[model samples]
Target: MNKAEIIVALDVPNAEAMEAKLQEMPDFIEWYKVGLEIFCAEGPAVLEPLKRRNKKIFLDLKLHDIPRTVGNAVKTAAAHGVNLMTVHAIGGRAMLEEAAKAAAKCENPPKLVAVTTLTSLSQEDFVDLGISRTVSEQAVELGRLCMASGIDGMVTSAHEAKALREAFPDALLVVPGIRMPEGDVGDQKRVASPSFAVEQGATHLVIGRPILQAEDPSAAATAMLNDMNK
Candidate 1:
């Protein structure tokens, strides 16, 4: 329930799948993230159960749209009592600002986080996307923009966590792309162990497959928490 175990990414298919994992929820992992897949399949209905359990929620919709649209979207998300939410920094400063402002208006505003370059993207991927800068460079630039726009945090790879912490010491760094030492990489290109991520100054680590796909998810989650404590 401490800051170190602040968030856990639930990248499963739907509420049913997520509920299966919820049975394995450890006391240490208090926060849960509802990403695109789960959101698209279950909508706000899925959130009710988590809310009843009094678990903090992070709605990872990764909203990317024009300023006005994104602002309205954030307002709706905030009303749902989510503790955190994400927007794509690629949506630009105007969109980021609008999202932040919308959340701020909520009686219990969710922390607005901007997603920089995705963990699945490599330097070559950036080149293929016609971006001249390296992924790290793009991440830093996007992070800076998000901070200026009053965002509460950023979702970045652990590879950039150190540099990002240096630039924004007080800002929360919610890192995905986390892998245990023996874990498979899956679709993520940039990854780090949970202990390494915490050592690198990440405020939160978003782990999915390693815990969710394990033979015993609660035990797996406990092991991850133990690793972070080390």
Candidate 2:
């Protein structure tokens, strides 16, 4: 079985808050996801501390733009020495292809993954947006497009991990919206337990609030890793 990795989400407001969370986490916590909130607040300067500590980064900006613009952005992110980054699969084939090419050209490229669907949305949400397909169908469709466009992985809800795994066995399926069985779901609509996601072949599990909001963040992260291993 593949060893599932845990990426603690640093969803803080500023660099100070991010640094505090980092201090609370255990050494075994190898990867940290620097999402929109903190990244936008602190910019690339925030990542320097993580690099100094030798921790891996998952830069989840979910880049969505025109081909040339997205490609340039990828080059810039790669220069920051991130281990992984995300783009929107909904951006279509040409944009994904360009992002892939940009990464390939970089000397120390970040592995690119595409976001399928946000876990916050439901079928009703899709209908409101005039998206005709169901959530599962949309994830698969976009995932297929990503592979063909040469992107390496996908950021999807754990609910869709099994289907994506069966469809693309070797593809990196990074699952977010993971909550412990006794934990609150918060804003996520399709959350699942860590064990369930790992069983479904999720390679990396992105957990934010459960660990970040715990009374003891390190204990919370350790418990989450235990759940994944179980």
Model 2 Cα shift for residue 124 (angstroms): 0.9
Worst 10 residues of 2 by lDDT: 1-10
Candidate 1: minimum summed lDDT over ten consecutive residues — where?
Answer: 1-10
TM-scores of all candidate predictions against the true structure: 0.96, 0.98
Find the candidate with the highest lDDT and give its number: 2
lDDT string, candidate 1, 1-230, tens digits: 13566477788888877888888878767889998888889888888878988999999999999999999998888788889899999999899999999988888988988899889899988889999997778878998999999998788888888888888888888999888898999999999999999888788889888888889888888888889989
Clashing pairs in 1: none
- Cα lDDT tens digits for candidate 2, 40-77: 89999999989999999999999999999999999999
